[model samples]
Target chain A: AQSVTQLDSHVSVSEGTPVLLRCNYSSSYSPSLFWYVQHPNKGLQLLLKYTSAATLVKGINGFEAEFKKSETSFHLTKPSAHMSDAAEYFCVVSDDRAAGNKLTFGGGTRVLVKP
Target chain B: SQTIHQWPATLVQPVGSPLSLECTVEGTSNPNLYWYRQAAGRGLQLLFYSVGIGQISSEVPQNLSASRPQDRQFILSSKKLLLSDSGFYLCAWVPTYQETQYFGPGTRLLVL
Candidate 1:
């Protein structure tokens, strides 16, 4: 079984400040991790993905996430926060062992950027 | 470029009504399609997935069922709607050679 837990249900940050959203996962095997962002009533957009190739992954919108196997963590981060960054962030884990690469999503962290 | 699409951006239905939500993918072949539902302020719940035409797998047992009649088309259906069925439904597709999935805009179904 594979699952992900988003540490924060909501996070608020001031503009230009660093942003961090934490996530932890439990998987039996080496898993593929992903960070996705969803704006209000919009489709989910992949921010980054870790496929065992890179421990530190860079993604769109100046976002990045580091996969820590020892810690069972994949935390999303950005150097600076922008108003447009306000959205729901989800941490997802997929184990090929699971049929069809079934993805398990975390509860999500709602980010609020204050300008 | 691959794109996923879901129909009836918004729907309102009464209890016991039949429900249907359709999803289609373009620019891709033999893509894996998935259906997910998100309740208010909740995480996504995988409902169904299809690896190919006429092959559907249900992740959760509920009033809903899924059908894949075409390679890139997946449909979710319910014979009787329940209030709990109201939620934002999303469709996603993973290219045959890709691991990351792309999502559709989603359909908001409101059951009364």
Candidate 2:
């Protein structure tokens, strides 16, 4: 079984501050992890993915996540938080060789950025 | 660039009403397609997926069904809408040789 856990239900921070959203996973097989963001009513946008290559994966809009196998974690981080960065974040995991790439999503973490 | 489109963007239907949602993809061929639902303040739930025309794999068994009549066209239908069916539905696709899945604009359904 594969599952992802986002440690925080919500996180609030001021602009220009470092941002961190924590996630941990449990998977029996080698897994592919991803970070996705949803702004308000918009659909989810892929942030980054870890597929056993580089542990640290960079994504769009200055977002990134590090795949830590020992801790079974993939935490999203950013040096600065823009107002535009306020959104819902989801951590996902799936078997690297799954038939349809079926993804198991975390409950979601809502980010609020204040100026 | 590959693109996926789902419509109508927002829908309100009465319970027991028949529902049909359409999704289409362009700029790619024989792409793998998926349908997922997300409830308010919840994560995405996989519903169905298709690798080719007329082939579909369902993740959740319910009143809903899916069909892929064409390579890039996917349809979601339900015999009758339920209050629990209300949610945001997304359509996504990945090229056969690619590993990443890209999503469409999504359709918000509200059942009353």
Candidate 3:
């Protein structure tokens, strides 16, 4: 079984300031982790993923996440927050037992960017 | 560029009414297709996935059924829909391996 827990249900940050969204996971296998963003009335978009690669993974829109194996965590971060960054963020874990890569998503965190 | 489309950005149906939602992907062949439902302020719940035409894998047990008549076309249907069937439905696709899955705009279904 694989599961993800987003530490924050909501996060607020001032524009131009740094942003951090925390996530923790539990998986029997090595685990593949992912972060996705969903703007209002839009579908989810992939931000980054950790698939047994380097600890630090860079993604689109000036975002990145560090996969800390020892901590069982993958936290998303950005140096500067933009107004456009206001959206819902989800952390995901894949169950290796499922062949089609069945994903288990976090409840999601709503990010509010204050200007 | 590959793109996926789901019909009727929004829908309102009565209970026990037959339901049909279609999804199609362009610029790709034999791609993996998936259908997911999202509750209000919650994560996605995968319903069905298809790897090829006429082959569908169900992830959840519900009145919903899926069909893949074409290599890139997937459809979700039910003989009758329940009031609990209403939610935001999304269709997605991925090439293979751990490639990122791309989602459609999503269909907001409200059953009354």
Candidate 4:
């Protein structure tokens, strides 16, 4: 079975400061990890994904995440947080062995960017 | 490019009312379609998924049912809405042999 856990339910950061959202996963097979952001009342937008390629993956809106095999973690980061960056982020894991590529989603982390 | 569409952007229904939410994918064929529900302040819960027309797999057992009448169209229905069913419903699609799922704008459902 594959599952994901977002370490923090909420993270507050000042505008222009760094932001970090932590996630950890458990999967039997090599997993495909993804980071998705959802603005208030909006649909989820894919920020980035790690499919066993580069350890460091860059995504839109200056967001990036590093996949650590040893740590079993994929933590999202932004060097500088913008006001628009305030949103809810989800960490998802997919196991190829699973039928239909079903995804397991974390509880989500809500980021608050204070101006 | 592939795009997913969900209708009834916002719905307010009473308990025991019938519910139907439609989702259609454009620019993709024989794709996998899924329906997810996000309760307030909670993560997404996989409700159902379909590999092809008339093939649906339910991940959770609740007061909901799904159908894929067409290759690109997936419908979620409920014979009666429960207060627990009130949440955001999202439709997503993944292309054949692809692992990435694209989501639609989602329909906000409020059961009163």
Kindly report the fnat of each predicted structure, to 2 decimals. Answer: 0.81, 0.71, 0.65, 0.81
Winning candidate number (TM-score)? 4
Against the true structure, whose DockQ is highest? 4
Model 4 residue pairs with clashes: none
Docking class of 4: high
Each candidate: RMSD: 0.8, 1.0, 1.4, 0.7
Candidate 1's C-alpha runs over 4 A off are none
Error of 4 at B30 (Å): 0.8
The DockQ-derived docking category for candidate 2 is: medium
lDDT of 4 by residue, A1-115 (tens): 8889999999999999999999999998899999999999999999999998999999999999999999999999999999999999999998977898899999999999999
- Under CAPRI classification, how is model 3 graded? medium
- Candidates' C-alpha lDDT: 0.94, 0.93, 0.91, 0.95
Worst 10 residues of 1 chain B by lDDT: B93-102
Which sequence of candidate numbers ranks them by lDDT, best first? 4, 1, 2, 3
How high a TM-score does candidate 3 get? 0.95
Comparing 1 and 4 by DockQ, which wins? 4
Rank candidates, TM-score, best first. 4, 1, 2, 3
Q: What tens digits encode model 2's per-residue C-alpha lDDT throughout A1-115?
A: 8889999999999999999999999999989898999998898899999989999999999999999999999999999999999999999887857787778899999999999
In model 2, which regions exceed 4 Å deviation?
none
* Candidate that beats the other on lDDT, 1 or 2, i.e. the better one: 1
